[model samples]
Target: MKTIDLRSDTVTLPAQSMMDAIASAQLGDDVFQEDPTTNELESLAADTMGKEAALLVPSGTMANLVAVLSHCERGSEVILGDQAHTFMYEAGGISAFGGIHSRQLPNQRDGTLKLEDVESAIRQDNVHFPPTRLICLENTHNRCFGMPLTVGYTKSVAQLAGDNGIAVHVDGARIFNAAAALKINVKELTGSVDSVSFCLSKGLSAPVGSLVCGSAEFIAQARRNRKALGGGMRQAGIIAAAGIEALKTMVDRISDDHRNAKILADGIAEIDGLSIDIDTVKTNIVYFSLKRLEIAGEVLVNRMSELGIHFFELSPHTYRLVTHADVDENDMDEALKVFKKVMADL
Candidate 1:
């Protein structure tokens, strides 16, 4: 049986074209700024996101951390959603390494911090409070059913931050997915932010790497932060080659992943013991819950795994599945069959 892996888009393999590009790529030391292929990738990334320049980093975590470090000084505070990947998943690198403080606001069901709430959270210029230096937003919010934040909402946040002299950084790991879902240019989503970090590994199908886009001066600062964090790479063109291919070939097809997610969501809704808010199936992520209280989420997940299907159990009752470049419509159908059978037997 073909094992259906739906855990996350991060599981996707690079395309054959990416491999070809890597094999023939020109190589040089990236730390010295002499790698031609890596330079090409950075220029392409900046152009794609409508930014002045871009810097390559090893992973999404490092990209966010570098962006935060470049924008804020020690003892400065950044406002972000409580459920943000930087806060919830990135191991608190910003606070630990940069001594920057975080002020987390509530993320709504649509994955936006209310304007009023954000305004209230900004610290006053008092001696006791850390000065607010930055605001962070996540596009295609992971925990919020992978919903894409609207262009209007992003501009509103940017305006708020600008008025307060705070820089805005977007953890845009799945930003292309957001653009495809919204039927808008990716630049429209990123134009207002001061800096944005996007992943090449997820959905884009690059083996490894992420890029941080911003003004040239900001990128120069971020490059220094990357080196300080031990993120600088030598002969990184081999990785950049694949990232170039992913950018050139993979972005247009993200809508297919979104379609497959809807298929999976609709199929799960038909199962007697499974439930999902079908309306929230906006991007490549599908989140559902086990309505049968007798069966725990782990039990169902284990049973499905044994049956050649795999996904994530987010809680005792909630589960998450993501569609990506590797998993096709047939895989969705097969996974849904397994889900139905497993739910019935349990």
Candidate 2:
């Protein structure tokens, strides 16, 4: 049987073309700001996103941390959704490394932090409270089944952040997915935020890295923060070359992954025991659960693995299925068959 890997888009390997770009990439020490390809990628990413400057970092986590450090001072607070990647999945890096505090509010099913709640959470210059310096958002929010937060929603948050003299940072690791889902240019959705970071590795299929873009001054500070975290790389252009190629040729293709995801979600929903919100499969990630099953999630996961169909856990009962460049029509069909077989055995 053919293997279907639906764990995440981060599982995607570089395409042959991207590998070629990597092999031919020019090299230099990026810490010296002389690596031509890294410089070019950062410049192009900044221009593409309508930001004053951009910095390349080793991973999305580094990009988010650098942005967090640039936006907040020690003991300052940053507000974000309780389910957000920055708050939940990032291992509390902001608080640990930057001495910033996280004030988390529950996210709506659609992956938005309630505007009114967020507004309420802003710290007054009380002699008693930690001052809130930042508000963060995620696009194509990972935990909410990859739902795309709308521009109007984002602009409202940005405006609210502005009202409170807080800078807004967008953890846009999959912002292109949101843009494609909303039928808007990625820049239009991101233009209002104070700083934004978008991944080059996920879905875009670059070998490594992400770009953090914002004001020139913010990026300068972010560069220093990156170095402080030991994120500064010498001669990083070899990997950066693939990032440039990924941006140039791969972003627009996420629509196909979205389409395939919809196909999988809709198909899985038709099964008797599978429970899924088809509408929530908005981007590349589809999350669903099995209803009243005798089988445990791990057991089913193992069963699916034996069938060469694969995914991962989000919770005790919930499973996450992601569609990416490697998963095409044939893979989706195989996955559906595996699902049916597993249900039958149960």
Candidate 3:
């Protein structure tokens, strides 16, 4: 049986066209800024995000870390959601490597931090508190049911940070999904922020790479930080070529993944022992709980694995499923059938 992998969009492989582009990629050392394909990808990424420039990094973690270090001084502070990927998932690189402090505020279910909460978190100029240097926001927040932060909310946070002389950096790993879901241009969400980093490896379907976009000066600093972290790649246009293809052709089709996720969420909700809020199935990520079922999440995972279905266990009872380029509506239907059979057996 063919496995229907719903664990993450990162599992997606590049299309054949991307492989062709990679095979024909123009090569030069990216560390020396001489690769034409890498330059094109960076330029395209900057144009997409409406930034002055962009730097391609090895992964989203390095992209965010570079942006953080570029914007903040050592021992400074960053304000972000408690559940944000930067704070919860990035292995504390900013604090570990940059000596920067992170102050996390609650992330509302809709994946927004309250404006009042952000205002209160900004530190005063007194020596008693670590100086607040930057504010970070995650688009299509990974852990918050993949909820997309609205342009209005992002602008508000940017305005708040601007007035306080603090920079705003968006961890936009799934930003294209956010743009597709909101039916708005990606620039509308990224316009006011100081920097935004988006992943090509996720739903964009590139094999490996993420771009950090910002003003030219900001990106210059980010490039240095990326090198310091050992993220520099020589002749990296092989992957950058695939990224160029992903950005050009794969953006609009993300809506199909969103549709499949909704279908999956609705189907799972109908099962007697499974539960999910179909409304939260806004983008490609679906989160459901095995609340009514008596079986443990681990047991369900093993059983599902035996049936050629796989997803991430978010907790002892909650699980996450993501639709991507490789999985289609038919695959979703098959996965749902497997889920129903598994629940019935339990």
Backbone clash count for every predicted candidate, in the order shown:
0, 1, 0
Tens digit of per-residue lDDT, candidate 3, span 1-346: 9999999999999999999999999999999999999999999999999999999999999999999999999989999999999998889999999999999999999889999999999999999999999999999999999999999999999999999999999999999999999999999999999999999999999999999999999999998999999999999999899999999999989999999999999899899888899888889999999875566678888899999999989877899999999999999999999999999988
Q: What is candidate 2's local distance difference test score?
A: 0.91
Give per-residue CA lDDT, model 2, range 17-128, as digits (tens).
9989989989999999999999999999999898999999999999999999999999999999999998888888998999998999999999999988998999999978
Clashing residue pairs in candidate 3, if any? none
Decreasing lDDT order of the candidates: 1, 3, 2
lDDT per prediction? 0.95, 0.91, 0.94
Best by lDDT: 1
The reply for model 2, stretches above 4 Å from the true place, is: none
Candidate 1: regions farther than 4 A off: none
